[model samples]
Target: MSIELDHTIVPSYDKLASAKLLAELLGVPWSPTALGPFAPVFVNEGLTLDFIQTDEDFPVYHFCFRVSQQTFDDILGRIKRAGISYRSSVRGPVDMRINTDYGGNMIYWNEPDGHQWEMLTVSYARQSA
Candidate 1:
């Protein structure tokens, strides 16, 4: 059998609001559904981001999306319009800057839960040392 990522549970203080924010930023559809006590945000047909309401602080995670050029531009524009802080590097200065390090344009931002989100226009294979 082939392997694929089906879904993931994202812990959030306010699951609905967090899911909505992610959906809006990624230009995806999200709604409250009965799925094992999760506020699922459907990113695509087979992939779902399930947001679970939690009181305890969870470790922040990084999520990256490989998108088209147009989508990248649109998301970046939305990020700027929403006044979301972004950076070219992981721990770099906070700005609306994009990096072209991996042969593609990439930008990083964080969600309300401090989860790092990344969008890139191209996929660069890892280089050997």
Candidate 2:
């Protein structure tokens, strides 16, 4: 048997708002769903971004994305232009540390629902890309 990430279901309080925020942040669009009390976004053809509006605070999860050095800088620029926080990285701009263990070449901030989100320059995703 082979295992892979099909999709993720996240607890959100305002799914529409969360979806909009994520779409803008990730530079993607949310697809229409049948009972869209949730909005679904695709990370690629394989994985999905699912939102579920709930009450209890969901534990913050750290996820990463790999981009070219230029793309990463542009994203960082956008984050700075938006007046968001960019903590000094222990590993420098090419690499960012989130805590110490769950670290990557990243820039992170709290999403609307307080989820720790990030964008990284190096993708530990696939060996090829």
Candidate 3:
């Protein structure tokens, strides 16, 4: 048997706007009310990000998406066009730079809710088969 991640709940100040922004940047499909009180962004056929509105304090999270080179370029272009700041290092300041130290392109950006979002071409954290 095989198990896969189906979906995750993302805490957001504005679920609609957050889900919409991520969907637009990733060029994915999303619905404001796909489910009860949650906005869903379809990352792919297998996975979905369900954004839920929250007012109480919540810890910021880090999300990493491994993408193809072309997809990375396209998403990065959209992020840039949206004027979102990005950095090469996860904890570094926004320098509008992409990191290639892992033999592939990678960048990190923070959403309005302070959740760190990452996109990379290669799986630096994956183990070799």
lDDT of each: 0.87, 0.66, 0.95
lDDT of 3 by residue, 32-116 (tens): 8674989999999999999999998999999999999999999999999999999999999889999999889999999999999
Q: Say what the RMSD of model 2 is.
A: 5.2
Best candidate, lDDT-wise? Answer: 3
Q: Considering summed lDDT, which 10 consecutive residues are worst modelled in model 1?
A: 120-129
Give the count of colliding residue pairs in each prediction: 0, 1, 0
List the RMSD of every prediction in angstroms: 2.2, 5.2, 0.9
Better of 1 and 3 by TM-score: 3
Q: Candidate 3: which stretches are off by over 4 Å?
A: 127-129
Q: In model 1, what lDDT does residue 46 have?
A: 82
Error of 2 at 53 (Å): 0.4
3-68: candidate 1 lDDT, tens digit per residue: 878999999999988999889988999987765689888888889989999999899988888899
TM-score of 1: 0.91
Give residue 96's error in model 2 in angstroms.
Answer: 12
Task: Look at candidate 2 and give me any clashing residue pairs.
Answer: 96-105
